[model samples]
Target: MASGSKWTYSQNKRFEDVLAEYAEDTPDRWHNVARAVGGGMTAEEAKWRYELLVKDVELIESGRVPFPKYGTPPGEAAAAKAAARTGRRG
Candidate 1:
């Protein structure tokens, strides 16, 4: 389990610390991930599972998603595409 408060950035740090051990053990589903981490853990907690981290890493490496605001950056991609359609710029 992660150290400190659930919402802290340090939680991510702790998650990273465990990434290697769990790297090859990513679960396909959130429930599986939670179970792997520990049964009775919530799906929300599964967000920190090594699988999600690997997925995020793949997103970065593939350039399928950008790096700001966790990649998509709230409405940014849609807004940019919309601007392009309207013949405008941000």
Candidate 2:
């Protein structure tokens, strides 16, 4: 469950979905994947499931893309501050 040091509910969910889809054994299925985590999946695994990460990152990034609201601006500084106070880097 603790996929990595930065894994969150959404990240874990994305990882699980990627695993399930990849397990289907359909190389052409083209699943989403992201290297958003430090060690949830190996580099090969992330590359194999690149689509899953794309989707996950898309979803996460979309919240602030074009214009980040909620005073979160989608920056490392804000993220770091948030993480320090709430343990959430994203």
**In candidate 1, what are the lDDT values of residues 1-90, reduced to their tens digit?**
542235445445544555444544566454554554453565576655545667888998899988746455446889999999999999
Estimate the lDDT of model 1: 0.60
Query: How displaced is residue 81 in candidate 1, in Å?
Result: 38
Clashing pairs in 2: 31-51, 31-52, 32-51, 32-52, 32-53, 33-50, 33-51, 33-52, 33-53, 34-53
Off by over 4 Å in 1: 1-6, 21-48, 69-90
Residue 80 in candidate 1 has what lDDT? 92
The 10-residue segment of model 1 with minimum total lDDT is 2-11
After superposition, which runs of candidate 2 have C-alpha atoms over 4 Å from their true positions?
A: 1-4, 28-90
Give the alpha carbon lDDT tens digit for every residue of 1-90 in model 2: 233355555565566675565554655333233333334455555654455556766877777444324333346667688789986554
Residue 21, model 1, lDDT:
47
Candidate 1 lands at a TM-score of 0.39
How well does candidate 1 score on lDDT at residue 45? 65
Name the candidate that leads on TM-score: 1
